[model samples]
Target: MTFVEELREHAELAGAPLPQLSDGRDRYGPVAAILFAQRSFASVRRRSNGTTLVTVWDHRGELAAWGQAPAVDDVVNTLRAWQDGVPLPELCSAVARYLQAGDPAAAIETLWSVLTDDGEPHLHAIVAAASADPTLRALRPWVSHGTLHLLHATDAVHGVRRGLAFHPTDEDAFKVHVYDGPIGPVQDVASAAATAAATAATW
Candidate 1:
């Protein structure tokens, strides 16, 4: 069975509706549904050029499954390389330096490689820089500011309490329920960005 067929079978087994497929030559093209849950499945389109694009709520559905997906190790290494012990301004400057060195795409690609890897301290810096930098503004829609803030806040609180385990601290306890879980902010930002970008794209 083709990849498309395999996707269909998986969906069917999961009790999802058979994805509506189309011929690219005449109609539109073979499209797949990504079952996010029992009641919701995202529409993903396969282009004639052999690209599988997953529609993100905001930006045109991203090219999720690239031909040569970078390995997890490569992503980890790239994230490690981007780490510079510095403030957000300095970090943004460093990223700008790389962008000015001739290849903005390479710079952005490196940032992406790091962000998608397991959560790292430097990932926060990268996100902050990318969110503010005009050169990297294209990445704004993808970065979850709310989620990042919550993660950092929670980690800080966890670290403090874990370090001072023998002694109970008011500050640590205060931060316990400071922010919502990872999903709340993530969905909020993604949903808002997706709506805005999709509307603009359609126009």
Candidate 2:
């Protein structure tokens, strides 16, 4: 099967639907792109040597950018290498430090990545809070969609399930709304990493 065909079938089977973009024809061949995360575009190009490469484009277009457009460092990486077994959105904002040219901490050029900008200060504060408090020491704090989550510090992927979820509140600067699970309150019995105190116990 062709690279794009296999990719499309696999993505569909995995339940993460990949939407098609413009059928751009570049020097390589007939270029095809998939728009999974907003503004994030990755192309599949099969080289003459039978190697398929995925080029992730970081563009500034009002919509998804063409596969042949200029990128941050114009680095070409294989889909598996670039994805690294993570979701597509990770690639959207993960294009930093390519060749060490741009600021590693600079925000990505996309609306989806920008949505989490409001919680930057809270993210820093939570890190400091977690560093001093031994209870939070074992749990790594992460922010998603402007909400703070504490996950087990297994590895760079924030391995283990997200333990405590904190939502910033307008009531006070230092205050937040803590939830139990990923998107809702923790379960009554099977709610924690160890047991109730880790899960069911209220913050």
What is the per-residue lDDT of model 1 for residues 1-203, given as tens digits with 9 covering 90 to 100? 65446555554564542444222211112233232322222234443554443321112222212112133222122122222222223322442222122233443343344344323343343344333434333331222322322122112322322110101122111111222212112223223333223332322
List, residue by residue over 1-203, the lDDT tens digit for candidate 2: 64455555655565543445334542222454433334345554443544333444444211222122233123223233343443434433453223221222221222112222222444444444443444554444445565545544442322333455544443123233344333443322112223323442333
Error of 2 at 102 (Å): 27
Top lDDT hit = 2
Q: Report the number of backbone clashes for model 1.
A: 4
lDDT of 2 at 106: 23
Give me the displacement of residue 55 in model 2, in angstroms: 15
TM per candidate: 0.20, 0.29
Which 10 successive residues of model 2 have the least lDDT summed?
106-115
Largest TM-score belongs to which candidate? 2
